[model samples]
Target chain A: MATMHTPQIVETNHPGHWKKSVKTGLKYIPLLILIFFFTFPLVFMIVSSFKRDNLQIFADLRSMRAFLPVGELTLDNYRAVFINSNFPRYLMNSIGLTIVTILLAMLVNSMAAYALSRLKWRGQKLALSVIIATLIIPGQAVIMPMLLLVASLPAISFEGGVIALTQGWLDTYYVQVIPFVTSAFSIFLFYQFFQDIPKELDEAALVDGANRFQIYYRIIVPMSGPVFASVAILTFISSWNAFLWPIMTVQSDNLRPVMVGLLFFFQRDVQWAEVMAYTTMITIPVLLFFFLFQSAFVKSVATSGLKG
Target chain B: MTAPTVPIEKSEGKPKKERQIIVGLLMAAPAFLLMILFLVTPFFGGIYFSFTNQRLIAATETEVVGFRNYTRLLSLSVLPLEPVVDETTGQPVLDETGELTYPRSREITRDEENYPQYAGLTEWFTFDVGDTRYVVLAGDPNFYRSIVNNFFFAIVVIPLQTGLALLLALLVNQGLRGQTFFRTMYFAPVVTSMVVVSIVWKFLYDPNNGLINEMISTLTFGAVGPINWLGNPSIAMWAIIIMSVWQGVGMQMMLFIAGLQQIPGSLYEATSIDGANTWQEFRHITLPGLRNVMVFIFLTITIAAFQLFDQVFVMTNGGPDNATTTTVFHMYREGFREQKIGYASAIAVIFFLIIVGINLIQRYAVKEKEA
Candidate 1:
């Protein structure tokens, strides 16, 4: 995970280094203590997640008491979530949505970016500006209107507005994935990076009889893999974690994503243990994905000046 | 380059510009269309509906009336949104404009008569709670209490959350051991479902058997026994705020860490050699180094906090006598719960304006300072 640091910063010793070090060290204590203070809640949550029952957790939730206790180790809760509940399906649903959205987003955003940044077109700046402006407008403001649009689509629509769609937009896979495919931020991210890439390659490709699509597909997209990975990681996390919009739209139990499924499962007149198991399972994929590619993605962002 | 499909005319015009523009439009068309249809159109429609009495559901048609929604929601004398402020003037607990911010709502407790005018409006809107004629009015006294309460939360929690995030960032960025683990742990909640967080926290804040109150009872001082974390209207806001900070600290911390990582070590060393103390070094070096990050994080956090909805939706529902109701939640209630879409749209519009204004002020402040 280590990367090259600015050389001058590598030598931190100063002439008054000892006295400054003392002060810095002194300052670190209170700061560290405060970090512990703020992080105590998370500490409690993780500890509680392992408990076999509530009594152990309640006994010493804040302290490390519960975690240390020789409580009965049980897989009952995890079993309940994995077998007794819809958690698996929800996980699949979430993964499906996230993967679909990620692929769709990369294609749409990169293509849009290629057009905006690499294509020497008049109004390229205008297109770029529009993409940036999209960032300013909050999504909540238009949710209701967006709901109407979702409900009114052709194949997705219900009969004569008599009801919501039959195989309606409600709970349909496309319904969940379609509205989210185009990300303004991703477009802007790639657009900025593409602008940095030399355009002479484009002229050469054009001279070699390459059509616009080939130039983008063969050259630009391949060269921009690092950023594409970063944007993909971000989109996957967001899609997996998204709660509100999905909850408001998706109605069928079969189509429920992990987050909502976990909510319902936890509230199932069941134990917190099962809930923890559900949460742990839901977190597994993202945790695995994050740990795997985070270094490469972070490097791309740092070098490219793309702020999340 | 096929020598330009139409070599001569294309060569004269360099037609690359027009073709590129066409490709740009085609590539972006879907997203552009969605933004307009889903975002901009609904916003304008929401404003229009805010003027009428629109209810959800297909069976019912809305009655169109100009300014009636506003007329209906006025807190006093049937007037809506009287500019309210926090008590003990200039406190973050209360905003400069009257409204409950929610995060720092620790300090307000109300007696029944505290907001009599608001009570009258609710009574009028509901056709009497138990037999009095209800009047819908702005500046109504009863609802005003909740407004003040909301301001308290926004002021206290917003800054507390942001400050704590910055602090954690500074600490965690000290080239410490297990840095990655700590960062991931801290960031867990940011990625977890807020509904789950809110529900779990609501259970924790459950007055009698709840962990927080239990801890308080064991403490040596300060009303340690059986404190009503959620039940008491006074303490409910703060209780919610505490949970919120816990739920949200991860994102801000991550952003700050990213910011801190960008700081140059040489600057710190140079300042140290110049014989500056730690605090002075922070003032001159750390603060300045993180200025861009600080501004971005600050503005982002504030905006997110201001639009507090999901947590409130799952946890308090702006309840325990409306102590935790925020501007956004209030708009939600007015539009969806009460079937007053027009009024809610007005609230949403005002909320939108606040967000935009805050962004503008941030932009100006940062630009001017940087210059």
Candidate 2:
């Protein structure tokens, strides 16, 4: 065995190693080309955002300089995006609402999934199947009626210590957060994960005189780190990236998310650099979030097939 | 011990059953309430709204007009009107005011001498009800066009994106250098918002100062002029398709990679021992192993393609002359832009059916293939 391994190591450093190395390197050419294909557009966006003028971007388009931060780069576009728009407000709205939504979703969806997977009761399977079936129904199919529903929903408001009853939930933060708190996809994912946990632990907890909720809170949730991470990342990305719903429901600038705020640039006189800068800014958070929870995100997508 | 155990177990079982029911219902209440309020109610409500004369601005009275919106949006099997003609002209003569007239008389057929102008009508289906004549032309041409556009997007994007994803996944499946870096970089756009992708690609497709045209010019040595990617109606949807494929290919790639990792390495070694070459091994082993994953990717990408809206909204706004107006986009425009809530609801209902139909067919196909 030692002798068999020695020749393989020796051949790598042998006299004709250069030829072997070249062959291996050549195999990666297609991969490099693909990487360039995927990365170049995003690189171009970042580079062009730094360029001062639309003319400058156009002038360098014929060469590799369009993707290189070579000449006349500045933060002027970023400055303009901050000063001339409600981008900061949009960013805050997205971050805050995404956090609130994720927290609520985790609490609510986990409980529901636990019940569906662990508890034995009448009509439990029927309820679980009914929830799963909704996954096939696209949101666009029901968005019209949802719009009408939200428009007529009862709400409560506080103004200067005076509480008033309101009829419509549209144009409110709850409209963005509350309706999405109990998604079928998230519940399904939790159910799949919860099924893997050992049932003997639940039996032990029950014998200890713990209630079902206590068993869940004390035992299952503590052991479900990976699932929570996956669900949190996926939910955060979606809520942050929500565009169509926000546009339909939200009319005020303060309530707009970052994705919808990109349209604010379009409504103005077309400024390509500022648009790129705004997109680049909004994209950085997503990239950061993705890199931080990269494995969990990939695992969630593979196992559950939920898209960000 | 046996006597006490039997009595206690019987006593505990009754309350346990009751408690299980209570606990299950209590835990699941929130999920059921939300789904019922949002998804189930709206699903049936949307279908109901399609049949009504509901306006966006609520009225004191909104009446259910049976099948009128559906007939107006799709084709009507029976149009209860007959042609009005004058004996003097014999050309289905106009009324006294020069209006071409159709009056309620008898159902007419395409075989009739003066069948209402079926000239240049591509979308028509006809069935007879015991010798009463009926010819169907599309009541709404734009809606039909939108459906065609949706299919076109799905047909082109699904295969291309899935193939690209599989190729990428295969490349990085081994213990290659910088494997994690490549995976993360490829998945960057998957995390990024669709709106951002559309905006960036819209800039790239700018006819005058766009990067794509400049690169094309350089590649061809100026033989090809800058193409109006988003401007020309013919190529507009194609531009959107390319951008969408780029934005979405990453998610599929990661999923494929996961699928690839699940295949046991022992099979490849066994194939090699049998003198199988690399291509042969891959063809026989890897492709067959990835069958289920490929079907999943196909179903998902196809469904997403059918729901194409944001890219069109952000990049082209369904224009230069509504070229990229997909079903969802048209529904949005009708509901929000034009405030034709009833008509838009009808579009939504049809869209729901189409999606459900596609998913069911795919599921059946995959099940059959597996069996």
Q: Report the number of the highest-lDDT candidate.
A: 2
The C-alpha TM-scores of every prediction are 0.78, 0.88
User: Against the native chain B, what TM-score does each candidate's chain B reach?
Assistant: 0.75, 0.81
Off by over 4 Å in 2: A1-14, A303-308, B1-10, B13-20, B76-137
Number of clashing pairs per prediction, in order:
45, 1
Model 2 Cα lDDT, one tens digit per residue, A56-87: 88888989998999898899999999989998
Q: After superposition, how far is residue B45 of candidate 2 from its true place, in Å?
A: 0.7
Cα-lDDT of candidate 2: 0.83
What's the lDDT of the predicted structure labeled candidate 1? 0.66
DockQ of each: 0.28, 0.53
Candidate maximizing TM-score: 2
Q: Which stretches of candidate 1 lie over 4 Å from their true place?
A: A1-52, A55-63, A120-123, A156-168, A295-308, B1-9, B12-22, B73-150, B176-181, B214-223, B257-266, B337-340
Model 2 agreement with the true structure over B46-68: per-residue lDDT tens digits: 88889987776776577899898
What C-alpha RMSD does candidate 2 show over the true interface residues after superposing them?
Answer: 4.3
